[model samples]
Target: MKLEDASSGSLGPVIEVIQSILNQTGYILPALVLFIIALAIKYPNRLPGTTDPKHRPGVYFPPGADPLIGHTRMIVGFGSEGQFENFKALSDATPAGSWNVSFLGTSSMTFVNRPEYLEYIQKTNFDNFPKGSQFTGRLGDLLGVTGIFVADGHPWKTQRKQASHMFSNREFNTWVRAVIHNELDDISALLDNVTAKNGPGKLILPELMFRYTLSSFAKMAFAANLNCLSPDPDSLKRPVPFAVAFDRAQAIINDRFITPGWYIWEKFNKTGRDMRSSIKTIREFGLDIIHKRLAERQDEKKDPLAPVEGTKKEQLKKEGKDLLDFFMDLTTDPEELLIVVLNFIIAGRDTTAQSLSWLFYELMAHPEHVPKIRKEIAEKFGEPEGGVRLDYESFRELPYTVACLHEAIRLHPAVPKNGKAVMKDDVIIPQGPNPDNLPPVRVFAGERVGWSDWVMARTPAIWGADCEEYNPSRFLETDEAGKLHLRNFGQWKSHYFNAGPRLCLGMNLATYEATAFIAAVLPRFNFEWATAAQGQKSAWPPQYANSVTHPIKDPYLVNVTRVKA
Candidate 1:
């Protein structure tokens, strides 16, 4: 009875307290309830940066954008290489060259597609544009601080001159070319394996292509060979850590657009940990080499710097021979040197491999095109010596093949989106064609512009109604006298090798590697669909933004067959 009475007393006090509170706040209660109700009424459920662009006051979404995530959903469903069609549709939905895209953390950013506009930003206003901090800062692992990819100001100039002088000069080309060509070993081995084992039936997708390129980069860039492809070899060598670090870094940069907090949040994620560790290894590796060389400085056997005696003597006596050798010729900023060279290897390795894979796919799908390309090769160089190579001039002259490769790059470039910052408050690009029938654009400081490569490559305004088609014929132009000039191959005389002072330094090398690899493989081997056992799940049914324009994600398990002689 005492317990029951105590419980009753507690209930009574609680009821009394509530009544007293309600009585004291009689006027405020209704207002509070009304405020809560009004908020729910005014704004329904809203995700960050996910809203109707037309109705939003500050950010603008393009016309017909889905209120939630805008074009994000549509783009996500399309694979990197496969996204061209959707990009075309979205492109056509707006102005030819200029439109606002919902990006950079759920906000709408401008998308520029016209050739003239690209040419201007590339050439005239090159000084004002640079890769943004957001893109570079994510590389906290692979690059210690600054790299040729991220640095601006006079620093970039110093690095550029050093890099270009070493890489572009004749001396570096001689040794570097031979080193890169040696990677063809893997390419040949892969083709021979495919041809001998598979016959005309099974398809083997090219995942080895990734490992091959990575190993090749080791040889060309560092004068070391990290063979990821040897039988019974552990593919995850030091290069894996380095490559992982770079991939995760770029991936985190890409994620900023979706979650916005990915870079920070990923601190606790698996890739983030891997990336951090990889950076430590890279630094240690670099330091070890530096110290070893210093130790060897006093030795008489073989000193790379033996020719240079004093501090200024060595400074005055550098030449380009390898990628690192080129970096050695440049500035003495050790941090920048390590960072930029690592970034360069990342760029050179994977992108070229991707292009080659796509080229193979295109060749197989368009089998007839293969014979034509082979005919061109036979005519130009003739009879296949196992080591028969096409020099730079010969590689450039294969118009149809070059056009086909251009089409592939156009539709499926490695870097799908370009991120650049508008330097200074006064920089603005006005819209309209530059007497060449192109669109107009304007840019401002702090504003980041990401022009979609797919949009520019396949936009109808740029490439006509059949812009999305993978037809090499589109790239061909026959003169009145029936002679084909190089102009017939690219819609823009430059097909996304990019334009301006910031053009890719590795363009010539990349093209040579890609063309040679393809020329060597296509005529000799045949690839079909991969086996069920070989197929792995693809994250690419809907590709993330981190990839090159595309990836062969469905675990391509194609058996290979040697072509009849």
Candidate 2:
């Protein structure tokens, strides 16, 4: 029996109640499972794994933890940003070979960050790792098992193929670049206001970068704009649909580490306690569009850009059959498109924004790099003759700027720590004998095999000892004569885009969004960190597991002073 059936056995009426919920929601399996798990958790004597491990060794936990909460106190008390420090400390403290990460109960969930081992897990024996219940189950209600983020085997394969063909086209890039240019004056205005106040400055809030990227994503993906001009005003315009919901979903996912806690009890209420309004907003927005679009498929034959049978002029004119349009074209299931778009929006906005924000922070932290970046920007098209945005080809040509951006991604991957589960009991990563009293350390069918966020990026094996350094030079090649080469610095050891078949589909889209936003912002002004911001540090773990990695903890309050030179 699945956890949903097994856990919710006594809530006999729950089957129908949950089915009704499943009907109302987009992610059927996950919603049903959430409710079922919620119902089941009320009685935990029946919980699994109470019995001691077959091999009784002293303790599977790490060294310095308090016997009671173990890492929970640090994780929960600290929040997401704090956990980054904790991980850094633990990583630095632990020597490579075999190390243990302490969880709630006994066995310390082992974390190995060496390169050769990292390669095995992420590639050589890739399928052995997949999204386990620890991560996916909690998000199931929100994501469902339908999309690429959750789908296994063929479903995932199809999701990849479809996205590659439709969303990755140059046409989408054209649309995105045009949207960014269309909004160029608006973004420049913000930079101008800031620069006048503080000489040269940048907005440290990843939210700004997020909005820029999201606006671009909105234009391309949904053909709508979040209207993210002024923060508070734009926020009120549509309420943040994607941000908080994703955060809450991720927080709940992270709560699993504490165990015997909130996850299973979240469903019995009118709405799952874990459900954030933003998740609903995002779903509603996407589904409403899907329904209206599907309801008028007849017009698709008439005019690709003309009004539908009954919609208004502006609506009628938006007849472009993008993937989202294709999604409407393909599935009647409510959760399907919403879930797909949910992941897509999350993928596009958060990651790109975070990357850009941190890149700026790095630039501000090292004012020297700004000249190099500015020179790269200037060399391409000379100076942007007054208040103008650099076009697409111009944006792509700036190699050093792209290098800085990739370097930021390497240091601070937005989607840090992706979880994957093994479909079978296999040696996914290289297997060495457990010291003793360990659970054989095999990559099982349903477990969070590893946290890939920083491991691969910082692997010495991948980028040498400089893996931990914030050098953009790694991404920019220098010829034997010391001349700078602009070769594509595409893949790094870090799975920031999550290597293998399950790589992020929005990679190119995000690149375009970041480049466009940067081209618009870089030359306009300089930046400085807020007193409390610049690399503030993670306050996580105690906060949530499934959170996006970004620079809020270290966000700078920049002055976007207009350039006089």
Candidate 3:
């Protein structure tokens, strides 16, 4: 008899026997459970056909992957502190440059560590490997389907085209410059006030950087002035509602990535409720700004030459327009407007703040490099005594400052890993040593392919033996005469800003802002890591919290004193 027919025929008798045994002694049930637990513990990845050494015809999966669950348990076991450790393990396991594994026993994931494969996925076959629905669906609740980050296909292309136009505008660059200068001035004043009140003030740099970037983006992109740097009692008491909501929404959205299925969270869970609430708060904030901007734009259209009677246009030229105004000209859909605005804010704010925080941490750790950066800035922009106003042209001259920012980001990239889902059956040719002379790995449709900037940036094969060290000088090359010169390693090799069609539109703006801020701050303040006592050793490599962007885990406390030049 066939197994199915035999099982069906014996079901009633088997149930009767089990029930009779259970009725007789409940202790047997516990013993059976213990036996199963022992078996699982002894052979975690021993599921049938998973550990076979034989290579499959299409793709090669590493030997240790569990047949169903994949590496989920191992990843979760590491927690936040050991997250990078787990990624390192995966990277080491994929000696042939790529490997396939099942996630949650439902979806197939192919991780690619080679730059050649990254080029293939992001550029050569970009259309074939779009950010598929699964990736978008995970972030849809928070980001919606309208923005470039989560958008795919025609919608993504349209958004990218529109954003590219706006970013390239000369007027937009001027507006960005004005916003950065103003925010940096505010930060300077705040620091001065702290120093005046208490000699050598201690500061949590990450928090301050976040506020600075948030306020800067708010003023430049949206016409809202969120006084995030204000020191007044009233301002301190009343926090920016939208800022809080946006942060909470991001946290909740990131949680979804590690969570299992949609039904588990969406059907009956507090996480779903919290997500909806956070999105509502964020949407409401974006809509309010959109409507306000729309009205202002309508007024301008009625009388183009008549300057708006306020400080709103202070940062913009008579003919200049903010991003929202640009979007208003394109589409009047509020949802679309909100998505675009939020997307820009997130891209601008989080990445810049995190990058700055990491830069400062590196500066504190390696104080010897500080004077070199300061000397370069002072030579170009004069001393930051009265305060330095960095414009588009002047900002480019401080190449050392820019190199420091790049080095920091290389070490601690904001968006460490980026994923793209395969829309068709695509084959990736291995670029590394194929000991088995393995053929091209055939990736199936619906499988997710990704590249980890965190892993790739630190790989010895790509960046050499000293890749783990924080040396900005690596970005600089010595000529035959032994004079050092800066090298522009473009986004393709860097991978921090990503590459191909989806390259970060705000790359220029982010680089300029970071460079300018460093120029402005370094000349005015004597920075050092805060110590428990004057004679004690300061904390060197700060503990960091792992996320899409790796931020310093705790407040990066630093002692700041006004420099006497």
Candidate 4:
């Protein structure tokens, strides 16, 4: 009887524990199974110990990528400062000049740094790879449906054709030149005033360059003077509304690139709200310009042969029209006009401004080149009594100046990387230092591919050991007669302005503007870093804002002194 009582006491607690576990298992089992199934569905190839045999055998990835999340943890961990560093690390690890990275599960991004891959994607398989919907959708709010930067297929082709005509027009080019000259004159005046107020004062060159480019484009495209660089008391107090809206819109749009499932985030978060507000501001600003331009056009039509009212309108003739007038003739849709004008303004403003800023940065960093450029400019254009006379013809004559611009662009490309979406299954055969002798990489449909011009321009294998150095003479060659001439590297090998059918349409205009602006300014001012500015060291390889155009990360400040005649 004693033994039976002892057994019962032990058995009672054991039975109770068994029953409790059984009851919990019923609920827990289903959730566990569901979680496993979700992982299987999302990352079938990513399960621990299971490798994807389908990927190019030599393709590499960062170590310790989670099966469920892939490289997301590492990428997110890097934050902003280390984002490009992560890419550089991957490139260094691989011998194929490419690497595969996954954000979550099987969703992957293949980064290609090979020149051959760039050619294949941009030219050989142009139709197969496109600026896919994801890219266009992300930029849609800012660029609109018709803007060439975000457009694809038919729309892109149509806009490119029309824009080409506008860009190539003699009258339009003349008007652009006039606008550039006027803006430069204003910049000179502003600098003079600053010098008078605070002798040898520090000037933020990037900000000044932005104002110059923005004001030039505003006058050329919108027939409105932003007076962005003006020292006028009225202009100083009130900022240009369009300029502010444009910058805000650009920042918001660029943020979408890093925002995962951006479409979803845009729909359900503060980012969406901010983007909407910026879009609204941009739309309203554009509409105001369009309305004003339409009224002006109507007035001109109502009274043909009447003398044009403003200095800007003088460029408009009954036979030849500026871009705004041309687009207004094509479609009265205010939104469409806004899209076209904004596209031009964004392209013309950012790229040129960033390019000039970097050019000056390089010049200040290497002052020895300044005298060479100035001497070249003087020899070609001749120093006038007042200042340099910069026209289209004279702009092209400065071979050394052009080479310097090219070198600067190479070191600091305005657009550092270009991306495309694989529309169909494609194979890329990478060239240059295929150390592992890797086979072609098969990119499945819907996969993303990116190429870094910045990387290619700096790679030792591609451009030789001194690729990182800012040597303007690299673009120049001496003839048998010992006279130096510009070597035409062309767009394909350079890739600075991109390549193939979709090459930047504003290349000529941008080149002309940069040349003119530099010519006008370099002859008059001696530029160097301010003592305080010098103390602020820019990060090597130069940090960049994650914008469509990767502008310099920090403000570049310099002191400008007028050159004595």
* Candidate 1 lDDT, 46-132, residue by residue in tens: 223333334422222444434334555544455334555555565666554565555434344555666655655666777766765
* lDDT against true structure, model 3: 0.72
The alpha-carbon deviation from the true structure for residue 7 of candidate 4, after best TM-score superposition, in angstroms, is: 20
What is candidate 1's CA lDDT for residue 432?
46
Order the candidates by TM-score, highest first.
4, 3, 1, 2
Candidate 3 wrong stretches, greater than 4 Å: 1-64, 231-238, 305-319, 430-439, 478-484, 532-540
Maximum-lDDT candidate: 4
For candidate 3, lDDT tens digit of each residue in 387-496?
67788666567767787888999988889877878777777765434444535666767667876778877787667899888899888876799765778776667888
**Model 4 lDDT at residue 3:** 38
Top TM-score model? 4
Per-residue lDDT tens digits for candidate 2, residues 1-565, read 6646744677657676766766778597786787667644542221222222222232133454443233445545445345655555555553442334434422224455443454566567766655545545555666766566666666777777777777656655555556667655666765555455434544545656666666666655656545555423234235455555665655555555444445446556423554655467656666776676565555656765555432222432433334566565456576677777766665676677778877777776667788887777777666765443666566457778777887878777887654455566554334343232222244333323455456556656446798777888766777899777656533334457766566677776667667777776677665544443443333321122335444355333554555564
lDDT (C-alpha) at residue 554 in model 1: 52
Candidate 4's residue-wise lDDT over 416-525, tens digit each? 77788887777887554555465677777767888777777777766779988999999999889987787887666688888889888888788888988888778888
lDDT of each: 0.58, 0.57, 0.72, 0.74
How many clashing residue pairs appear in each of the predictions shown? 20, 35, 0, 0
| RMSD after Cα superposition, model 4 | 4.7
Show where candidate 4 strays beyond 4 Å.
1-54, 104-106, 231-238, 305-320, 430-439, 533-542
Error of 3 at 486 (Å): 2.6
